[model samples]
Target: MQKLSNLIGLPVLETVTGTQIGMVEEVLLDIDQAVICGVLIDSENWFFKAYGIGFEDLFSIGRDAIMVRGSEVIKDLADLSALSSIYRLQDLTSKQIFTETGFLLGILMDVVFDVITGEIRAYQVSDSIITDLLYGRQTMPLPQAQVIGPDKVIVPDTMAKLLHAEQIL
Candidate 1:
């Protein structure tokens, strides 16, 4: 698994032409599915609209760059219906996390995802920015989000032990 945040800023390369087209600006995440649907590419020109590549259209994600079969894989953001109106990684990061039973876990930090499938496997959380800087964050297996609202996310109550145990460890 790879951290989704790591993909940001990676160049998007067209394999057939051996040309660099754009860089990853952000990721479109389907929160309900716990998977990344596509990526938003940074437009090289200020006046040009940014584009996106659906997960299925990507050729591969490498250590240094993201590869696409060709430039045809890129499309206007509006053309990517599956990704056009979904939650983004930025939308969820820093959102508060709570248990179904109303216990506060921490703040959402980053997610570990399957590089090939885009499936979210785990979450990194921090009690606070201060604590995070001092002691580091905790990584917990995601049991699926029970609730995702504008400002907060709720996870299964069972995750409480998982998170707390990791803290003790």
Candidate 2:
């Protein structure tokens, strides 16, 4: 399982010309559908801002860098402007987790996913405690999200523990 944080700042390389394009600034996700679509390539150019590319354009996502087929696959359109309003991976942190039966679980710490498929595999729930660094915090694996909303995330009651954040280790 790979954490979403690992993709940040990874370099993007074009395979056709074998040229370095830029680094991955953030992973673009489809929140409602709960799928990672692509990445926003970091750029320093004044005229050209972030270069966005979809997963279909990717040759491979590797340990070293993100590989693309060519420059043509990159998108610089304004269509993605509204994506900023959508919830991102960063927003998941500290978001309350609610059960389908209406119960608060804990703060979401990290998400685990399949590297090849870009599917969210499991959630690592935590207490957000500094002492958790030394002693392990109680965790519950949320296999999938039932609903992702502006203020909170809902997972099936069966998947997560009933304990609250303050109750966990």
Candidate with top TM-score is 1
After best superposition, candidate 2 residue 92: deviation in angstroms?
2.5
The 0-to-1 C-alpha lDDT of every candidate, in the order given, reads 0.80, 0.67
**Predicted structure 1, TM vs. truth:** 0.84
What would the TM-scores of all predictions be?
0.84, 0.74
Query: What local lDDT score does residue 147 receive in model 2, on the 0 to 100 scale?
Result: 77
lDDT of 2 by residue, 19-107 (tens): 88878877766655556777777676535565678876788888778898887787863466357534456767667787898887766
Quote the lDDT for 10 in model 2. 90
Point out where model 1 deviates above 4 Å: 45-50, 79-85, 129-135, 164-169
Per-residue lDDT of model 1, residues 36-114, tens digit only? 8889998755345647898989899887899998988887765443453477788878889899889999988887788
